[model samples]
Target: MMSLAYFNGNIIGIDDPVIPIDERGHQFGDGVYEVIRFYQGKPFMLKEHLDRLFMSAKAIKLEIGKEQEELEALMLELAGKSGLADADLYVQVTRGVAPRNHLFPKCPASLSITVKPARELSHQVRSEGVHIVLLPDERWQNCYIKSLNLLPNVLAKQEAFEQGCFESVLVRDGMITEGSSTNVFIVKEGKVQTRPLSRYILAGITRLAVKEITGEQGIPFIERAFRPEELLEADEVFLTSTTSEVLAVTAADGRQIGDGQPGPVTRRLYECFQQKIKAM
Candidate 1:
């Protein structure tokens, strides 16, 4: 499988040094991004990803310089060039290359895209489930925006990794918000619950898919805030993202959840998720 990249108007190598030092995205984390996954050479939800990309750009007052359809076409072209049946398409838009300054520059926005092989978790891990640690959410208030300011997330994820965990569940205001890079969910009494869409958590595409799946399956899906304690006491805990479609969390903060294994509801949801992917 080959990887491809596109910067501005030209397609280039993945690691090419095309971005200047003064670029807003390089100097200051002044940008927005999206990660869309293509399954069997077909994007799972291209329009939803593009809509979120534009929404993030608008949130940061960054003009993407290209319309939604134009950007979508460009991403598709780049993904096609990669020649990979399953790929992760990353799109980043910044405020262009200009002298390093705190203010926005009067220049066109920079659009960069890369298509790489899709990463999947090992079957062993998926079956056994993964452990996670609860970390404080030190990120900015605008977590809803898919901005490039990810230092807090990086740190939390690294901490979890170092602790022999798969991911870090972030807690804000004594309540569980989300994972370092995934949306958190809990299953209790045969019902699913997750945090509502707010300025604190992202409106994840996979999370939306899970909501729809629950509806179609006659499963109860509730949107509300829950504390870390509630998460630990839940019968099953799971996470969702573009990459981690439906991952079960068997432990958190060294405490075993449920039977300390992937629960029936989580497995059922994952099976349903795979079916959805197959249907795509």
Candidate 2:
């Protein structure tokens, strides 16, 4: 039941003030991050998560100063040290500490990591399902990159919370993009449809898991864009992320979805996802 943190090469308290004010990640949001979940002390899809982390760092033109295997080993070592069987491991790579400037600094990159207990959704919420709010997607065009620039997402999530909703479904150009922190999916006629991978939406690992489950289960999985109206009209809707895996959305903007309950298709997918975890 302990939370651990690692800054640079030293393990420290989770709330340690080791980062300097001139750090680019603190000053300019110049960094990329990843959150990997451990189930029963085993990391799920760790290679895929690391691949995306490197991709995000390259997209930001920030050298991580460590090989992929090296970073992976470090993360595993830190998680083991935390002694938590189920945990959320957050890894952040920044452009390093330097004088205040808009230009890149000639310094080594900074690495920060934290391992905390997993934040599992309550059984009541998962069984009963959750509600969401539709909002305009105001983020930059590079939503594919897992960068530290999350002010727009934070604002949208806060707005949803104020409206007594669990999440915010964002729309861009009249088509539903994604949630502030999850991938959106709609089920119609027993087929699952989600927005395709693009610069406008992130390629979520949990979303990929759902795709694999649908394939193995012989369920139709479509990667195509749909409008808000389509989502409203969908027989069922759900969201996926590292934390909220295969969560059902029972209502949107106070409107009931699919008899206002978690649908059969969603439950099937979620059960398959849990089996995937068990086999991991």
Candidate 3:
């Protein structure tokens, strides 16, 4: 299906004009955003995504001005109109249009949303695993907030591209924080470990699902910060995100992770993820 845009209360063509040049989101990146994915015409974890979107708005002191039910209704309607079996709905709420300044705007906040076809990662990426590079985590402390400011993340992805890698494993002070746009996890001695929630990590929705799966299946999951070297040395490594899902990270810094292939644990979690999406 072709793409479309939902600017505030109006739905229109994707190329149509909606935002002004003085929009706060454009001027100062004073906004929060969320990417909600649809599977077979149903949104996966719609409630969780909306909750996180509001949490991000609160962290930025921005008011979305719409109740949760209202937002969800509008989003689902847009998704239905998108005409695609699988798509991505991007919603962003900004502090509104105002003159360039660091101070908060006196105007009411504005919202914008768009629905586009989802890009499916190659099955080969999951079957053969993928390589990633190590890059220093130079972003702000409030990584938990899904803000519009992504300059550092963009650069990190660029570094990974130059190195012929799928993503960059971001490290802060010798500890693994996450990937450029994903949450990193490792399997060590048959146990799963990922960094605990903090201002340093985004606390991904997919990460939550994996942990829950581990718990229900008695897989022994641990939430703690593991060093970069530890990730390299783990029996298996993987990254999770809204779109990427459970992707195995085979090699980092030219060194093999585990047996240089997707491990049994990673494969099992990925299968569980598929089941969850199907049930949705």
Candidate 4:
């Protein structure tokens, strides 16, 4: 079956869903977006994703153009129409359509919602983990805002793919920052260490949840930047995102990371994460 999308309140095929060329999101990448997953027809962490979406929009001074509750209802409706019980929902709110200009247009925001099947990680990738290559961070400083400007990430991911890796691990100033589309974490001395919440990285919802779960479960968690050399010496490496959840990085630049397998701590957190979603 063809995928369905909800563009400005209209249900349409994904192939032909329409957005004006003058739309600021298309013209200048002036927009904020979120990707939330659904299991059994219900969105997981819907409230948290919406909260982040609003935070992102506000950071750019763009209005959401709808009540939070109304947006949630509409998203659920779109998910139902798409007939995707297990999928990823993509939603965007742009500064709206207007003549090409750097300044914000005097108009209401334009909303776009699309639903598609969630691509599950290959069993090999999950079980054997994946390779990653370090790249210099070239994104703007305001990476905290989940905006539509993703050229840097795109380039990094493309580089990783070309290098036979699964994801690009970004390093800024010799210190590991994050993955192209996920948060980076390292296990050292039986504790989890990750970059602190800063203007340099997006505060991933899954990242925050994992921190909480680890704390509650008595797993030591630290928020701080570690140098590339430090990451190389760490016991295990992993990346987290809304969809990827907690994924181990078994190899970096052809070097094995802690026996070249997902470590025990990562597996424990992964199990805890799954339990949280099931309980939801």
Estimated TM-score per prediction?
0.99, 0.99, 0.98, 0.97
Number of clashes in model 3? 0
lDDT of 1: 0.94
Q: Using lDDT as the measure, what is the rank order of every candidate, best first? A: 2, 1, 3, 4
Best by TM-score: 2
Clashes of each: 0, 0, 0, 0
lDDT tens digits, residue span 1-280, model 4: 2357887768888889499989999999999999999887889889999999999999999998899999999999888887877889999999998999998889989999889998789888878888999989999999999999999999999999999999999988888889999999999988999999999999999999899899889989999989988888789999999889899999998888999999999988989998888888
Error of 3 at 213 (Å): 0.9
How does model 2 fare in lDDT?
A: 0.96
Residue pairs clashing in model 2 are: none
> Mind giving the per-residue lDDT tens digits that candidate 1 earns over 5-33?
99989999988889888889988989999
User: Tens-digit lDDT track for model 2 on 1-280?
Assistant: 6899999999998998899999999999999999999999999899999999999999989999999999999999999999999999999999999998999899999999999999999999999999999999999999999999999999999999999999999999999999999999999999999999999999999999999999999999999999999999899999999999999999998899989999999999999999999998
Better of 3 and 4 by lDDT: 3
lDDT of candidates 1 onward, in order = 0.94, 0.96, 0.92, 0.91
Pairs clashing in candidate 1? none
Answer with 3 or 4, whichever has the higher TM-score: 3
The weakest ten consecutive residues by lDDT in model 2 span 12-21
Q: Model 4: runs farther than 4 Å from truth? A: none
lDDT of 3 by residue, 97-205 (tens): 8888899979988899899999899978879999999989999999999999999999999999999999999999889999999999999988999999999999799
